[model samples]
Target: MTSPFDFDRELAELGAAHLLRRRRQVAPLVPPMDLQPDQEHLRGTTYLIDGQERLSFGSNDYLGLSQHPAVIAAAQQAAARYGVGATASPLVCGHSPAHESLEHELAALVGLPRALYFYAGYAANVGIVPALVGKGDAIFSDALNHACLIDGARLSRADIYVLPHRDLAALEAQLQASEAPRKLVITDAVFSMDGTVADVPALLALCERHDAWLLIDDAHGFGVLGAQGEGTLAHFGIVGQGGVAPEWQGRLGRLVYMATLGKAAGVSGAFVAGEPAVIEWIMQKARTYMFATGAPPMVAEALRAAVQLILAEPWRRQHLQALQRQLREGLQAAGVPWDLWPSDTAIQPLVIGRNESALKVMAALDRQGVWVPAIRPPTVPKGSARLRISLSAAHTGEHVARLVEALRQAA
Candidate 1:
């Protein structure tokens, strides 16, 4: 007879392995009694966990635009004007002026001919991959790519080769060996867990030599990298104020770029920008975009305001970089046992190696009123569990200093 399902036993095994996960209920900052009434109205950077306020270092609100007055106001206005939901799929009656305008703005921001919006970053990857290639095609992906990209490659029914993380030689070899009719190279512009950026220009070169399509998921780089916040492409000097480099400008047709709004943009939803024809193809064939109810029009409006803020305020990115530098330098000075993964970005990961050790450090930090989440497998490779410290522009220097001191005491 077939064995009966045993969730209890499986859960017990996971617990014994120290890989089980739990969620904590958290409330955004509540003002202290000593603060004035006007100051009380201002949101703080701490979170209340288990009835204790803790300084948060585990959020992905990199630019801290999530609580911006303009973004919130725009959302309110759109909700009043358009209501709460789209109520239909994009292909049906769901498309709105807000969505269209956001799409146009995103394409321009990313220096692409057209763009297609999705409900989330995961949806964009899962949907776009299959829409582009399948069956006889081949997909070259990075070993440490986001789960969504891995899932997308699997779902495509294509020949999948996962190259070692950031190994350009391996990637090139795979690309060269593939004889499939359509070849696509997909990678994250920033590896989320390790917090290191990919060499996009080099990847583009390989793709060009191999005559393969290059898709870069710049979710982490979008609002934080470029001078004008144009994302990884701009950071590489491939595209700038004038436009894409002349030599590579014509190759834009084969390049696909995606960025999610929830991270740096401080909103929800994601967009894929590329050649007009590629977007048109995705619109018709991407099932996730076709079958799912469209994202709320209000969200699209809020995202438009977010894009404007990203472009208008360069100081947000500057302040964020300063905070990152402060945290890194402070940690080094404190001589903490755990070293952060080499990353100049806002995502500074302190690898704790073993799962139990990571959990212990996380708990210790919690006791000291610092909230940094312990990230474990299968989010990262086994034996490399870490404390993922996601810095935000809103974080003060004093906050960073406090966290450093907390680390010293906790250690």
Candidate 2:
């Protein structure tokens, strides 16, 4: 039986390399309001990890609407009406009014004609990619795209050409070379690990020239970038059909936009927005969407509230920008012995060259009552292991100062 698969040896190897992943039971708050983020106190951003309190920089709740009174109230109301679970697939009576409303709002926000919601970002990508492209097609992917996108490309059974990250010339050349029946280009709007943004307008232009489909996974951009928090498209002034703003528009030929609500929106689930016909095609053909149970109606309602908060509370984005500058300036002044990679977004990566060293830094911060995740390969490249410090609007200036001080001590 091939030596019983050698589970123990494989696990031991993983452990030895400082890459064995483990989960600590994390309570979202430090007190009895544990399930909720305490958004009004000095300990507002604290989390109870394995029963120990730690000021955390490990969450993607960028706009901090997860525990807003309005969001919570909306969820409570929906749960009272529809119960907690969606109870069925969207095709089998699970697509409720809340979901439909949320989808419409999402489409309009992104300037697309329609949108389809998914239970998670991963599911959306893995399903949408294969739904629209298959064996005879070709997919051009960015090297640093998220795992979900990579998995989707692999599953599509299409010819995948992975160009170097952000190498537009190489991508163009590859597109020029591919003579497949159909061509698709896939990339992350904001790379998860490094926090660098893709040149989306240029990519879209290239796709148009080559008559290819462009898919942008905006997991890290939605609710974080743009004047109205409309994600990366808004940041670059690319508006589509049904988009109300008179933002800059190009020939937008064929594009598919996907963004998650769980990150900056501070809720659960994701949505794919594009032309109505394309969305209908995905809904009709995607196995993940057709077979899986929909997210609860309460989640849909909560996301509605989150969407409103995103549009109404401009201060959150402004405050976030201020905090980013503060953190960057403080760290540069401290001369911390690691590279703080450049980013214009909320996700900040401090690159520590070796795996063990990154973990050491994480441990040091943890000991100082602060928590940031040590991200190692295969999440990142082998030598570029880092502590991915994610900030949120819930965090205060004092919180940033505390983290800076702790890092200075660790250094």
| Model 1 per-residue lDDT tens digits across residues 252-306 | 7788999999999988989999888999999999889999999999999999999
Could you give candidate 2's per-residue lDDT for residues 61-115 as a string of tens digits? 8877776778888999999999999999999999999999999998877777799
Angstrom error at residue 68, model 1: 0.9
Candidate 1 error regions (>4 Å): 1-4, 31-44
Reference-based TM-score of each model: 0.96, 0.96
Considering summed lDDT, which 10 consecutive residues are worst modelled in model 1?
33-42
Q: List the residue pairs that clash in candidate 1.
A: none
How many backbone overlaps does candidate 1 show? 0
